[model samples]
Target: MEKERRWTEKYRHLLQAFYFAFTNGYARGYTNGMIFTGKSKYLCVPGLNCYSCPGAIGACPIGSLQAILGSNTYRISLYVSGMLALFGVFFGRLVCGFLCPFGLVQDLLYKIPFPIKKKNLPAHNQLKYLRYVILAVFVILLTSLIHDVTGTGIPWFCEWICPSGTLLAGVPLMILNPEFREAIGFQFFWKMGILLVIMLGSVAYYRPFCKYLCPLGAIYGVFNPVSTYRLVIDKEKCVNCGSCQKACLMDIRTNQTPNSPDCIRCLKCVSACPTGAIDSSWNIARSKFESRLLSEEENSPNPEVTKTTLLAILTIIAGLATMVSTFKYNLDGVLVYHFSGLTSGRGVLAYMLVTLFKGIVSFFMIITGYKLFINRNDENAVHRFREQTRMILKFVIIIVIAGIASLFADLSLLSVMFNAILICPFPIIGLPLLASAASSTDKLVQGKGSAVLWWIVFVLLAVVTSYIAYISTVIILAG
Candidate 1:
């Protein structure tokens, strides 16, 4: 009996892996080559696979939906909506469970051997509703409204929040094209930050993004209750032993309810049922009952050393390294400064602002990395670090605003002082503040008043430094 159960589990994994490879088989131009531009792309896949993926042969439904909604013609396609509905009714979240490449990634991440085990946090249940909100807002309303107003609508979710898009398409495309890397700006950084957060969150939680943010998952979840392919419990056979519920990675109480929206139809519960009670049904076709019942002992969660954590850690490290490398390599030859002349002092100020903007983005990247890899489990520590990071960003913004105002005042001294001050604190003070925020005991600032006081001191220092630099420049001109 034990051996048979093991074989079943092995077969399931093999089948899932096979599907993953088959779905993404067009690996010809995967490494920065042109995406598949064939007619197959006109058809939408039932999962979150990005059309822009070089290996992807089919388009992502959510991406296609947004494109149609945001088109200049503002045309809504019944075919797209109808196809999605048909898949939802037929398979429910079976696609997410068995087909989605991104879903496979999350499952594999959870299987990583990490010593720090965490249960669902408070408010986790409430957070599940967020995916629905994302579907309604970013995927639908925002896409339609923005296109109507601007005549050029952005795929808000894909552009700003889709980690699957970032992983499958954005990163690969960027690596393939040097021109794309050079063209990256604030938008790229913002998306990477989101991807980093989602990746890290997946490490600690099972399918965190699907639970809270995936609009595609949200859509298919709505059809779970009524889908033809469903998990049904034999009420007479179920002894209410709770084994099925314990084995459910989705946190679903299978003893009470079998057809939950949260269920990915993973069949982990079906395999765990000791009474041979739980079964999968497809339009009157039910799985056969086994003569032997598996032991409950086999349901224990395994915690072994796996490559998933190492992979996640490496990804975060690579992202940070890439950002630093890009900044360093492009500093002197940043194209923005070349295209726009800095002959006037105002132009120089604008250039400085652009530099500062990049610095702010770096700050976000660093903070997100720290949160994902370092202070992930400690909620209080994460909150404190966010607050401190925001304080530093606010200081940078204030300094830039002060520099712009100084330009209008004709105070060349103030301008020099602002530049000097901006150059000073980030390394000397801001980095330390970030480090302290991650610490167990140290507080960067005691309170809001202390934070405000430090900002004022920095502003004063800028004023004084500008005055000195201004006087020196005038002296040099006279000499």
Candidate 2:
């Protein structure tokens, strides 16, 4: 019996590790410019896998939840909600124990060879409720509420808080994309700080994020009592031993409540049960019977909706201000033009960096303006026009800055690289934005020749830019 229990524990760990590897097998550590953009990305995985990971083939449920909520549509995505509900109802927190990449990370972190001591600190139990608070405020309320006021919603939790995302996706992307590294600001540092704290906490506590701050975990946990898959306690076979509770990483009092909300369905309790009193099952009737035997309600504090509203409003204002400042700074100062005699190697590198920066900035600006235009109601047409004008002014300022910098140095290589990067991404990103903007303008103001004229001018500019880039590249290479 002891040997069988040991094997069960070992096999569970191996199974979890297998699932982690299987889910992230696309790039498989070959972090070049490789990302799986296949059809599988539309599907949400049952675990917290970062979509930005080079190897990830599926979207993260929490990230998707936040994104749909924060969309301008302001409608709940039945597809995403249905997926989450299905996963929760069927498997409960088994997803956390046997699937989540971050859950596996925490488990491995806890196993490091150190004098690891588990302490039941004061307020530890209360901390378990924090994930629910995060779910309510960041994942659901903030995303749905912010779009009404800002014309654009922020994925507040994913953008500002997800440590798993920072570690799994942000770090790898920054390492791979030099342009993303160059664009890093205070937010990157803030996220790294959060990731660091979580890492350190994971070393000491078992599944700290799952226990205290995973919104997905909180979501799955709600179905613990009635989920089709469940952990059951056989009172007839029980010896009043506390071994199962001791084995539980989630700090679940399994002897008293087998299907506790905090349980990860890890089966550690099942393995540790001395008299084989604990078992797992897939019967709805059994789950219902077990739930009746042990009934406990988890009490969580209600979120302050008023405070959340005020914070969301302030965040949008602050974000817009920051965006303007960052855009101006990137355009004016990100590229440094050397007046010294440039070597071929140095010139090429410098040209590439500047071009990359310009491409990224242009893509963002066009997308932002496009979203504002399309999402604006008739009453907000003037506001959208003003915003678009400001963006255009910013673009003009960037062009002027580049022109001034060109005068100080040999711009042959720089101009070629800049135009190449600009023209390539502009069509990919700008075409959609332009089409959307034109469509929106036509609907709002009929007989608007201004939109048509602007479209013609943009086409002309693109053609001219592409021609210049092609000619310059040919000339430089030939020389």
Candidate 3:
């Protein structure tokens, strides 16, 4: 019963992690609104995953690593490596705990109501080096075959390999969109089979990929030694009964040191420690909360709003914004086409209005997103929001990159502006808007029309941004 209380919320954090991994809003600003039919946005997140998955918001690290290697011009991807460093310094293996959607998926898979127990499978601890080997092989293959000499290698991991991208984004989308299904070939089947194997393996192990083959884990582990937050073992309170080691799914010997990069911070052993010797703190500082809490709800915010609901709401807002924006921009595109051969300025003005409207919508999105973070009392919400914001910034960056590319491809100022606006929603302003609305609604119960008006504006902004983005894509492609 005690163990259940301590670890009940452990799964919740994992749930939020999954949400961030799959959901676009969490990864917003991460991918920069650049879909990967490919031009030259080489370099993705430096992890084991692939980017071609539809759910990915930011560039996949492994994909980006391969691209950097493949490109002769940029010898190394300083940006991606640096981002990983920054992430590790602050978060450590906590990334596995809070940000990885794949990790969350594995956790969910493990909880299938089937009887499962932690297995102590011992092998060469050196087996942990396999991800680096994979990284090295990818780099060698990609860099060695650089197409500039013959100009050919695109380093096709996402298309030819990558189970996460295959399972989460590729197969499902292909099923839903016939064009994608038709695009499938032998490679798709091969990848799907591999994904099936990994899915089954994950059911038996705590996290097979994370434990064995995740290059991102290896990189982040390097920084865990000095990261701001880490696990600390209080030797003074030591009974050293080996209960922690017994409980640790990672097989960590937590008595001596608890900062192993391999440790997932799942807090299982923390709960298992009979002497209360194990603790988590930032920079060796003392912690406010202990390993065991009497009530699980004490750690959560608005227990009423589950992590899934937060994820759903975020997705709804982002999708709505994109959809609404797409519709409005398409309407404007039709009007502009009608006026194109006649008076050019009218069409230009109309285009500009569409662009402006998208910008407004983006502002609302960014504002709303940020506001949610500000008021996020739940630890899971805070964790998810931070990653979401980071990814949002990245998303904006890629959109800016894409916008520049559009310029070279003869894309219009209005179109570029529209894309830029649609891509960069003002999540920072979201908190104030929500707060004001809440306060206003509470004070003026009958005058709810005003609150509704605010919501309508918010919704309209999203629509306009999506429309502008959709129309811009059409115009760019058509031209």
Specify the highest-lDDT model's number. Answer: 2
For 158-263, candidate 3 gives per-residue lDDT tens digits of 5454677776677657755667777788888898887887677677767776776666777787777688867778789888799988887777887766888787
Clashing pairs in 2: none
Per-model TM against the reference: 0.57, 0.57, 0.53
Tens-digit lDDT string for candidate 2 (163-269): 98898888988988888889999999999998988788778777788888899999999988888878877889888688987888777779798888888877888
Summing lDDT over every window of 10 consecutive residues in candidate 2, give the lowest-scoring window: 297-306
Between candidates 1 and 2, the one scoring higher on lDDT is 2
Output the better candidate (1/3) by TM-score.
1
lDDT of each: 0.67, 0.68, 0.58
> Mind giving the per-residue lDDT tens digits that candidate 1 earns over 1-479?
33444455557656667876765678785754668877888789888998888788888999999998888875675878998999999999988888788888888887787775454545978988989999999988898887545596678999889999889888998998787789999988999999888777777778888788899888888898898888778899999999987888788898687888888877778788888777667612622322121222244232111111221232244334434533543344345555564334554555455455545545554555455455434435444654555655665566556556656655544645454444433333443443333342233234565455445445544543464465457547857
Model 3: worst 10 consecutive residues (lDDT sum): 286-295
Model 1 has an lDDT value of 0.67
Candidates 2 and 3, the one with greater TM-score: 2
Off by over 4 Å in 2: 1-6, 119-121, 148-150, 283-479
Predicted structure 1, TM vs. truth: 0.57
